[model samples]
Target: MLTENVHIAVPTAFSEDESLHIQGTIDHIRSLYEQGVKSVLVSGTTGEQHSLNLQEKMELINGLEQEEELMDNMEIIFGVSSIRQKEAEELAERIRPTKLAGIMLGYPPYVRPTQEEALIYSEKIIQLSNKPAILYNNPNRTGFDLSAESIIQISKIDLVVGIKDAGSKEKVEHIKSDTHRNDLHFYAGGEEELEEKVLHGYDRLSSIAGNISPAKISQWFEKMLKQQKVTTQESEEIEAIMGQVYQGNAIVNVKKILNQQGIPMGICRSPIGNV
Candidate 1:
């Protein structure tokens, strides 16, 4: 079982020429590990996984494999999603034998498959990876919403452990009431409106802001989960951090902040940071 309550969705590093910089990515992850961060999600939306080709992703995975300390010590979850099901399947298979902790299985963007098709896609990837799965459903981005019925059905699969951005409070409650599983975790996608999310039964965090302020964000989230009050000073600090991360494009802002800190996160792949 994936045990981390919070995981940083890290950005993939790109060179000046916009090439994948595998070492740079690993270096940032190493920095987080050194800072007492126990888990991270690579190649998710923050990692710009859609911008990376299969070959580059394979290279990145291989690079992570070589980092024995990080691989062995952290619950390093990888993101697996592609417009093509075959590509996602292949990627899942590649991760099947890896030291990777688990997967953030996102719905395919643009194609917007039907509920049945989406369920099939989810099951196939979950089967191939044979790892704990956190189903990611972003209707705004993917234009395909996984209904509560679908969520309940998918949650029955033992490999399926959780769901990210699983929708509003009512939907989450519905799923909770309908599903028989006791271990399913509800992960708020980012730090935005997080207090409300936690109140609404979001028990886990796939954190974007944590990339920049891992300890602070994690601590703040822990307090929220515990129903503890955040001091005024801490609240102000979190507001500042949220502004830095959520202003403009979040991925771009995070890369810039990380680069300033000397982690060599580089720039977002073209079009994104293309000023």
Candidate 2:
């Protein structure tokens, strides 16, 4: 079971010429590990997974395998999705033998596979990877919404532990009420309207801001989860952090901050930072 209440969806670092900077990516992850982040989601939307080809994705997995300490300690959840199901399967097979803790299985964007097709895609990847899985539903980006019924059905799979950005309060409530499993986690992606999402039944977090301030974000999220009070000072601090992160392109801003701190995060793959 994936036990962490929160995990940072880290960005993939790239050099000036837009080549993958595998070491830079690992370096940032190691820094987060040092700062007490227990989990991270690599190659997710924030990591620009869709922008990377299969070869690049495989190279990242290889790079991560080299970091023995990070692999052993952190719950590193990899993101697996490709327009081509065959490629996704190949990646799943590749991850099957690694020390990776889990996978965040996202639907292929643009293609917009039907719910039945989507279910099959989800099942095949989960079975092949043989890792705990988090179903990621981002219709805004993917243009395919995994319906509440589909989510309930997928939750029956022993390998699927949670769902991220799983639609509205009604959908989440419906899935929770109907699913046989009680431990199904609803993960709120990023810090946007997080309190509302929590009230509506989002029990876990896929944190983007945590990349910059892991301890602080974790503290706030825990307090929110437990219904604990936040001091005025903490509220202001969190607001500032949120503004710094959420005001614009969060990934670009985060990379810039890390770079400014001398972490060598470099620039985001072009077109991302082009604006």
Candidate 3:
């Protein structure tokens, strides 16, 4: 059982006027490294890819590779989600030349395409980009479930390398039983699941919780890998505090966490509001 380090899919902090130009974001990426993050995912859902225009999206991708800490140690995954297949493929192709670690594509949000349709979408993206892509199968966020059968079949294509999982125990188990290759990576999200999921052969975690309390997130990730039993010594505490902060002001709490560490932290976009 080889487990990779956790990845912080950071949410971009914007300026007051719906911009993600703050220096605090890059600074935060550095801070996350200090806390034991092995990878950084930019322009993903956590990074608010949905909010930014094409230019802004590319800028965010550019920023991650520019940071020294991120450039060297961290594996940077460009999370590209779009309503149109051609658009996602185009973005994937354009950034292939950059120092991007890989591509992570979530299911197109607006339309719930059938599994076959999704496969075609992924195939076209691969054909267009000719770069490795991570299949981001998050059903809770995407509406329809992307099946393991589809993913395993898609894995035959050289481009689809991994998946950021958001399915249930059974679904994961199904994939686990079906999937056998080491090149294909599977990362889990959500805080409560860290301990349990790691035990069950998950390779990595692309965590939102890892953002605010990365030290704790790192501890949990390592403990889950090395220690006999999982420890929630830090996880529970951070969640309790962040839970309140999240309720009142997620943006402020995220910013405070980033600023405390010296990242290019700033405000959230308009649609996101205070959080």
Candidate 4:
């Protein structure tokens, strides 16, 4: 089980020439591990997953596998989604033997498959990975919303442990009532409107800002989950952190911050930070 309440969705590092910097990426995760972070999501949106080709992703996985300390200690969840189902399936198969803790199974952006097709895609990837899965339903980005019915149906697989950006409060209520699985977690994709989302039943966080301030972010989130009040000073500090993270393109801003901190996060792939 992915037992971490918060996992930083880390960005993949690239050189100035935009080639994958495997060591740089590993170093950032290692930094997080040193800060007492329990888990991280690699190659997700922040990691420029789609921008990475299958070969590059394979190399990244190979790189992570070589880090014995991190591989043994961190609950490293890899993102597995592609416009091509075959590519996604192949990624899942490769991950099957890895020590990777789980997968964030996302929908194919711009493809917008029907509910039935999405369900089938979900089942296939989950089966192949043979690991706990967190279904990612970012309709705003993917153009395909996994409906509450579809979410409830997919949650039956047992390996499907959670859903990220699971839509409105009403939708979450509907799924919660229907799924009959009390264990199904609702993961807020980022910290935006997070308090409300938690009230709406988002029990976990796929944190972006945590890439910058792991201890502060994780502690604040844990307090919120426990219904503890955030002190005014804590709120001010978090506001400053969010300003740094969410002020610009989040991925781009994060890379710049990590770079400034001497973590070697480099930059985002072109067209993202290009502007």
Segments in model 3 whose C-alpha atoms lie over 4 Å from true places: 1-3, 34-36, 230-252, 259-264
Residue lDDT tens for model 4, 108-152: 999899999999999999999999999998888878999999999
> TM-score of each candidate?
0.98, 0.99, 0.84, 0.98
Give the TM-score comparing model 2 with the true structure, all chains together. Answer: 0.99
Q: Write the per-residue lDDT of candidate 1 for residues 1-275, one digit (tens) a residue.
A: 89999999999999999999999999999999999999999997673878888888899999999999999999999999999999999999999999999999998888889999999999999999999999999998889999999999999999999999999999999999999778999999899999999999999999999998999999999999998989999999999999999988899999999999999988887788877
Please rank every candidate by TM-score, starting with the best.
Answer: 2, 4, 1, 3
Which residue pairs clash in candidate 2?
Answer: none
Model 4: lDDT of residue 109: 91
Worst 10 residues of 4 by lDDT: 42-51
User: On a 0 to 100 scale, what is the lDDT of residue 67 in model 2?
Assistant: 95
**All candidates: CA RMSD in angstroms?**
0.9, 0.8, 3.2, 0.8
* Counted clashes in each candidate structure: 0, 0, 11, 0
lDDT by residue for model 2 (1-275), tens: 89999999998999999999999999999999999999999997684999999999999999999999999999999999999999999999999999999999999999989989999999999999999999999998888999999999988999999999998989988998899688899999999999999999999999999999999999999999999999999999999999999888999999999999888888887788898
lDDT of all the models against the reference?
Answer: 0.93, 0.93, 0.70, 0.93
**Candidate 1 global lDDT:** 0.93
Q: To one decimal, what is the Cα RMSD in angstroms of model 1 from the true structure?
A: 0.9
Whichever of 1 and 3 has more TM-score, that candidate is 1
Regions more than 4 Å wrong, model 1: none
